[model samples]
Target: MTASVLDCISLSYQPLWGKARSLTGLALFVQPLAEPPVPGPIDARALLETIGETLPADGPPLFVVPQSKALLLDTLAAVEPPPAPGAPGPRFATRGAATPTVVVPSFLLQDDSLVATGVRLGRDRGLKLVWQGSADAPPADDIRDGFHRYWLDLPPPWAAAALKDATRKAAVGQQIGPGRLPPGHIYGGIESRVLMEYCLDRCKALALAGWPGEDVVYSLRHQAMQPSHAVVMATLKAVESDRSAETVERILSEDPLLVYRFLVYANSPALGLRNPIESVRHGMMMLGIETIRTWLGQQVPYASREPALRPVNAQLVLRARLMDRLLDAGIEEALRREVSLCGLFSGLDLLLNEPLGVLLPRLRLSRRVQDATIMRTGPYGPSLEVALALESSDPSGVQALCAAHEMEPGRVNRALLDVLSEVDPDGPTI
Candidate 1:
């Protein structure tokens, strides 16, 4: 079969988490590396036939967003409702044959003709139509019965919060129940545990499109490691067992908090170092395995036992690895490792409760890494930007960055997937 347009494109994604941070689906953004020279819109055939091929059959549902109306219509046309039970179908079809959820941009709602056609296609084909707009964004003046069937986007940012807050106040006044959600609302970009609880527990939203891990980790600030420090304890054992610097760094860096602490301790006045520690490798060498072992021993008793911390730390480390993958592989091993550190420490600001400029400069990172991480400039800036773009999982943002940097989108997407596929010694990938 001829390759679909997906072959020349880079796809960025956000794993949509439902209540309790459960994996609901993966939202894949389509970005074309090279624009079509022909006078036509992009194709959506590949979204079904090509892009979906890259994902696991049994994995979460795939949410594919296309840039053009033609592609949107085409996608709706391509997917047919599942066959009736006992009907003829491919062998193992039920095992890994998850169809993608087609996302129709809010702009499409503006055109009555297009919206009508899209709704018809969706209903006829039995495709899941997710309207990417406010929960109330369906046409108000000329409401169509079919519009109600479309899955709504997360309520406009703050819209839900505003309503929820108002309801809370009203409930306090009249003693009414708190939930005000329209049944079956789909929320995205949720970043709060409080809001998550309201939506999931009270309003009972169908699914949420965000992760509250960062807030969970932030609440853990100034707290010692909990009992979940088993991983940390194991790494300390590695150091005690005379493990190589490489092995220890690999084990220790798995915990973002530990990595940050190591750098802080290594650069502390107690160490009396004129120059700052550059990498985990350097920190381990300067401090010596014995001292490092002893420091870790002190931490294990109080290390974080929070399970939520695992995924957060995993994501930070993966972002770092993705940045390293974005770098030219033929580059010197040392420089490559330095670039990876920039990625690793990209989240340092979140961990340390201080801006990266304040935290990183004290460590005396190389000017290039400093520029890339803090200033988003110099040689390594592009990789860091791309890494962030992927993290944000915005297709247009990824497209804009790739175009600005003259970087290939396909290569960047591949790099992200590659890093995500890597095996983590400490635990599961996020």
Candidate 2:
């Protein structure tokens, strides 16, 4: 496709967790990059087909269509099944055989006709429906039980807090009635509320049991697993300032591991090194300050001695790479570097079991970087938000963040895919 045409289509996937926090499903999203300067009805079917073609062969099965393209579901429903081999049949009837679940905004449920049509289509094709609701207008009673209702508007952190509050209430309810509480009493009469609360507590307890805690975080950052403090601090200082090669080398030589890793990375196949890196100075001369800084930033996670932190480190690198790639071309090189730092440090709190407010100051990060990473309030904030939103299963949240930043969802999706491909070439589609 031409650049202009390619720019029109953007696709990304969100992971859905099952009861055990296992990845049970994948929700695919195709968002239009343009905001339609001139408002008009979009060609939903054509767009859907285009999106389907762009997806990887082993990409997610569930596809989320924006409410603006509600007609796409209708189009799928109208498709006829193929005839028997011996019978004369329409050539196009065999298409639309895939019965991937179609998730739409809950507001669409307000339309009875659309809901009825969707139900009929779902039943006919063995498809499923998921309604994503906003805080202002959740799913209605009549349709709530029939489909999945994912609450949006609130970010993942806020949603988690709300769930914790609910879990607490449910614990109290459990104390009121030890035995099996009556059904239909949940959130209704006093008895029902108590029973419902108890059930909620039980569910929350079961879920939390499988989750990792501060101990895991602490273990990952154990003294043995920690990187060379002097080398790390020196590298940070070198990257923050326009230090000379002699300064950079002196700092790197303080730690043998730092020197070894830098040499290995500088000569790695990915860098396509023409000659072997003889020393830190040689690598610095061959790769420039910015490249070296980025390389050092990525090394932080890999430096961990704990094998379990490999996945976490990979995720941080992926986020940093994706954020760097998604940055607008107009962004200054320095700001881009800061944005990359923000992405790398975004998860440090979970990694080190320490708040960013404490960690960032220790690193002497610039005020802008500190604000973006800790407070999520700086020029790079939107980029970080976009990165986090890309990891979310909520399409509404992703769309809202993209819109707010005037970012093209397609571009963000493309950047994410590129980063994943580079980071984990053999891994499954994310």
Candidate 3:
């Protein structure tokens, strides 16, 4: 055996977040071998013996053995089963149910490969094959230390770069996993961070490609909440190839906050509507497609902080909303939706204490909004002049955009006063 030769495989696991309290239910990460061992023919007996010997002597530890696909199947076959009825198996499971099995991946698996074998066994025996390094359940501290030590022990530079690159790649891929959004606040842990970054990248790419803002916003919502990258990629491709409103609505329905906001905007007086649009689809229909796209662009800041400078934030959202409503050529529903969304999200910078780019995704906004936040660098940046101009009591900027649009600034001013009256009868409209 050479330096590349395995002394024995050890259990290693990394969670997306949180500390592991026990080893029983957690999936184990198989620490990587320091060197690439020779590709010799698979040997089941030798591998099992090596694993058993390497199992930690003390302090509850699970053995996570990695071997060639052939050897793993052979070893599983040779392993002892039921300790006779009324006896317990080494792992826990309900009566007649298969024990849980974890399958951690360092790289993409080959089809019909080693992992596939384990998956087949899991399905047949009713075992659960969980990916260990998930965002929801972080690795235990002790386990993380063990893996870090093992990684550090490897040869310098090359080993370090490889580990870093692998983690980044894994994080990028993990943006879309096949799991449901953890219940409660939609995001706040490891998963949210990865998804936010992924959404940002997508927004950047779309902006560079000159994709429409509405399309981009819709895409982010579809991808950000999904469980896996494969799904996100598939949905993105579908939407891009065919800009379908129905698909976008289905994705938006997943988040309650988004739904409520949409409904509220759909029914607002800004829409000048006699009746409310009750359903998401009906609301979408009542609001023209282009305007809805604009709304999506503004949705990213839904979770933004309620600005400390309440008046300032209000003016920001208000100005942007007014611009959207005034400039829009769509139906009342669409214009109202766009203006309200812009108003709601425009003051995000004041609240988040960061640039719009840094704060937008935290709002879990659609891709369109992300683009407007980042790439709309021109004078017409969606929330740019409007937000700033609102602060100027003179309202010169508002006068300018209104002049450019050939609309009377008085009507717009009246609209502002109207909204302010509703917001606070005692407060003066500056």
Candidate 4:
């Protein structure tokens, strides 16, 4: 059989942070799901090619592939680069022109012969080697001279906290001298445990600090204010029309703050504008009605008087974009719009301190959108579940939702990666 097993595999990337919290590398893991129905030895070349196709062309050069023995022996062994100039080697070009530095598990060094062969082949093909240590495979002194770099794998449960500690240690290590311990030395099991405990304490503190409690929600709603209902209605209406210059201008006139924010966003570095937007009419023409619609929709929920809600607002925008991308190519245009709305409104109860049953009616959303957001049972509900699953880092939940909706994990991951870039092109994707 052809290597259809490769289709079942998915890549999950974890970002490695440096001293300044900058992206130093990416750790790629092949999520070990249930075996494909037509199981045999997976075609290593095909699996690598499939993964290569899914990765962004401009991603980081350092890749930490999984340390599975099968992958080490079959996959890495088979990944050969193009032949050197006027010399004999593999004819086919792998993935792309960039030869990534592959970080394998330290256990591979246990077999000295394998290490020698793999290192020689990797060097010849321009692939540098780094060694990663895990709980099961600790670093060995024998392999110390084989690789130039070393990384420790953080256990999944404490990964976030460990990464934070590691970043802090790295930052401090940069400023200290000979007596000080470096980041590498501080990122071991004991440090991770301490960081994890600290993280738990911080989480408890945040929980008690009025984040999602009803009191906090109520306080936020009482203090927060949104744009005028008339302006909102007019803007929504303008979005449906062919030429809305007059409507848009009137709305801008009513709310100068809206005008200022719109101009700022339009002219922001993210949009890469050559000339400044001079008027609402200019913005309308340049950004188009749909872009303006989405922007306006985002502003309504996010324009809170309380500064604490800023992060919440950002999260709402992220959810909307994520849902939009996830539903791409899968639903009708109108349904896609509704799905985006559902995502935006999913947090309405928390944002407004009112039940969605009471709050959604005010927005005059469609019955299906209301059902999906409030009850979580409708055509759009499954997509929302998938989005939430991803947000919560629940892989099993995400897989179940994806399977129920006939969505491919690879496509979902690709969609998520694209949305992440769109949301924060310059920020690290973690």
Candidate 5:
């Protein structure tokens, strides 16, 4: 397509993809690269490194695929045994958290086709593949073909025929839910309101039809954010309210993806470190609930919501975490947890271009989490507001907001830097 044509299209196109297409159009206008899809081998290591680089400090969970050829042994060795038939899975080594991985069984098999691998990962992660393979090289068309075939094979009894028809109906503004949803869609914006509503409707529909809600939530998060964050959110939410450690352990035993990410992040300089966290369980034990919650909040990627929005989440999270630390404010750890959650999802609906009310149900978040996310008039809402204001680089506005709490902008700024340093001592200082 011509640059002008692409420009006329929504900016929702992946930035990297848009840039690639723009360059390709220019190149084709001049002289074409000998290859069509610009073929090359997928570099797993390089892709991981780039993901690690692109990751935001206070973003959503990072979904990482191992080097296509990398062994799962590194992550699997530590997995606890699955639970007995009726028992809870192994508790995340932490009190209230899992080790932070989402295991996708089929990803074990890899092939020369990038698309095939991507489909497997997406199915395993329960998300739509966003940045499939790596950015270092382009895939052969074989990859894309294989991916479609695999995806077509992954869905349950809902035949590809049925699912395709349903998707088409949804696209044309047909009755998609138990109730009418506002017109906004993912192709439009990146606010939390838009995303939550879209997901909720889909989840409700699945539940109404007696299907598992996991797949629907996964698709929403993927379409709204990226596969990594989407899967993390879906996986974590899938844990039953009364779930025990045994149940968690069982899930982890088979989920290598979650294990790898947990260990990687646990040891990553991004989490601030004097040494590498050696195991998922060990990391969970050492990180504690508050720290783990913070990490999860950061890992929830909303990058695809809007290009301009990518950094906004990071800034808000940085500010919220900093404020929590500065006042040593005698605030409950749970409140800090709320702050982190609010910061991450505050713009979810906007990013996905859906309504908050429509999507909140899919998350199955506590009334507290839901209240904070929607009303912004609740306990955690004020902090979210402050975090967002500061994200715009408006120190004065932040100061004004904190005035009631007897806090100062300078103090908030310094504390935020300190918190950022503490969270990622060895990674980027900011």
Candidate 6:
């Protein structure tokens, strides 16, 4: 698609959390240029194709929830599943590998036209239909059997109170009756940790549709963030093969905690280095490839085995990469790399368990990086802010941020898509 199409739309992703807080997939939200730009009701098939190109072949399943009937039909028709493994074709095409899931709101099932023939088409095409509804409403019996899984919304506060005030009210804890919300349906719109836990732990919900932003888990800030052993091993491999410092540094960026630890180790008095090692590239150079390899080896066992944290680090890395991309191409590579770090460490306080004001000082990072991460100022600050706004899929917020900085929204969009499109998952392509 042309750049104009991309400019007319904005994309935001919400991670889906499954068992053990593992990231199961992403909910791709597409907003068609509204003023403030909340994810719009219906997205075009072109938008899906555009997004599909960016996702890795092996990335987690993607769920698209369309808010309009025509759009839903068009969306389903736009993609064809991969012709089995050995079929005649490229291994993976964006449309074929889009994998067949379209989250249909419960209300949509009421359409007489849909139940009549649409259900048949879904089955014929190998589509996986998922039902989305609230605690008080569900699909009618006629269309209920078509969906593979259901996405149920918890009872609203008023509804719970109303149910409690009824003559034959649901007793405490029975407000979400199986009759309305069958067990095993994924919980949708999980905005907080409490809701996420109740659905995954207390209720029998199979998975969650959205993450409770990290702010909700502020208490976990002090808990040590774990680095994926897989990533650590990758860094070690790169170093052992005598890859350029840039290559090793890119691998290190995949896991911020590992990068932090590396910087800390490089700065240790044991090294007796004359200079500070603030960035991963700098650390690799000062510490030497052999020293880095030995250190990474020692870290393999200490790495985290939890499946959940992989996406956490991946998302952070993407933001940093986007920040770097948003800068003018003419800018020197060193400044660009430094700005990327500003985005990378922006949230280190949460992972590192100390305020950046205090934590960043110990690392002795450059003033610009510190200012952007801590004070949210400096030349790097605008790009970081824009990157964050883009995450929300609020086109207006992104536009405003760009305008304020005299940056172009088109460039921001290009930068974001470029970073996201290039994602290479740690696991095999699905």
Q: Which number leads on TM-score?
A: 1
Q: Tell how far residue 172 is off in model 5, in angstroms.
A: 37
124-223 in candidate 1: lDDT tens per residue?
6555566676666565444344433344555565555544664464434575455665546567666666666666666667666646777776667777
Q: What is the TM-score of each candidate against the true structure?
A: 0.75, 0.49, 0.26, 0.51, 0.31, 0.73
Q: Is candidate 3 or candidate 6 better by TM-score?
A: 6
Question: C-alpha displacement of 204 in model 6, angstroms?
Answer: 7.1
Candidate 5's displacement at residue 341, Å, is 0.6
lDDT of 2 by residue, 22-119 (tens): 23344556555445332444445544444434444333343455544445455346333334458664222123323345666555556666765665
Question: Model 1 compared with the native: what TM-score?
Answer: 0.75
Clashing pairs in 1: 225-302, 225-303, 225-304, 226-303, 226-304, 226-305, 228-305
Reference-based lDDT, residue 239, model 4: 69
C-alpha RMSD of each candidate structure in angstroms? 5.3, 12.0, 24.9, 11.6, 21.1, 6.6
Residue pairs in clash, model 6: 58-429, 58-430
- Residue 222, model 3: Cα distance from true site in angstroms: 34
The residue-by-residue lDDT of candidate 6 on 135-183, one tens digit each, is 6677767666667888777667733543333324466877644322345
Deviation (Å) of 215 in candidate 6: 8.5
Say which prediction, candidate 2 or candidate 5, comes out ahead on lDDT.
Answer: 2
lDDT of 6 at 321: 85
- Candidate 6, residue 224: Cα displacement in angstroms equals 4.7
Residue 127 of candidate 1: its Cα lDDT? 52
lDDT, candidate 4, 1-430, per-residue tens: 3435434554444433333222334445553345544555556666555445545445544353644556565655666653467875442224352334466666656666776566656655554466666533555554455454555434665565444543454355365222212233213232232342232232211111002223334554546545333345556666666545775654443332344456667766777757655445556778877888888887866553433333344445556657778775857655765776677667766755568788655443468887888998887787787777665312456566777888877667666656644433233111
Model 4: worst 10 consecutive residues (lDDT sum): 203-212
Residue-level lDDT of model 3, residues 160-260, one tens digit each, is: 44334333533554653322222111111111223323322321111000112222233344323212222223333434455577676544532333554
Q: List residue ranges in candidate 1 displaced over 4 A.
A: 1-10, 31-34, 37-43, 47-49, 79-97, 112-115, 139-178, 182-185, 212-254, 266-277, 281-295, 305-315, 420-429
Worst 10 residues of 3 by lDDT: 203-212
Misplaced by over 4 Å in model 3 are 1-313, 332-335, 362-368, 375-384, 404-411, 425-430
Alpha carbon deviation, residue 314, candidate 1 (Å)? 5.0
Rank order by TM-score, top first?
1, 6, 4, 2, 5, 3
